[model samples]
Target: MKDLIKDVHENGVKSDYKEPKLYDVVPKEEIAEFEEVMREIIADIVSEASDVACWVYVQKYVKHKPLDDMLQEWSEASQFILAMDTWFERLMAD
Candidate 1:
């Protein structure tokens, strides 16, 4: 209570106002460029994983499931991996 009263007397009665800050400090264009590069890298990873998955599926097929099934599984796995990476990034950000 004493600290609040002191703050009101020194600064102002309205204590809710906040000063803005440049938290990240990086430029918007640079951030966008970095994101584009990361997306390209992720796409390459998904493509390579899908290629390997195709070969592995062909080698393991018994009843001979369609190629679409293998592709779908690979796509889902890639997305899951990407999602996990996103979750980790969010955790680190906090």
Candidate 2:
């Protein structure tokens, strides 16, 4: 029983880390939208167009808007993109 609860919690956390709150409403759709937006987010990051893009997305989508914490915010978006790439690779492999 304990192991079952742990497994359930672990699975819950993984979904949260990837697509966030919207994942619950429609996990597949939310993940798809995230992958699409992440592409543009990364292009902006690479070109150094505006670090602000990361904040804009968070402020709009995420509920609690953190005040301009670039390091954490960038890391979150960076990791999110990395996660997407890993999933995509696995998805393609199958």
Tell me the tens digit of each residue's lDDT in model 2 across 1-94.
6776687787763333355466666577578888788898899776653444444444534744443443355665665544444454466579
lDDT of 1 at 58: 53
* Model 2 per-residue lDDT at 79: 52
Quote each prediction's TM-score.
0.38, 0.25
Tens digits of per-residue lDDT for model 1 on 1-94?
8999798999987777577543355576687777788899999988876666445445335546454454465665655444444454466579
Off by over 4 Å in 2: 1-26, 49-94
TM-score of 2: 0.25
**Candidate maximizing lDDT:** 1
Model 1 residue 79 CA deviation in Å: 18
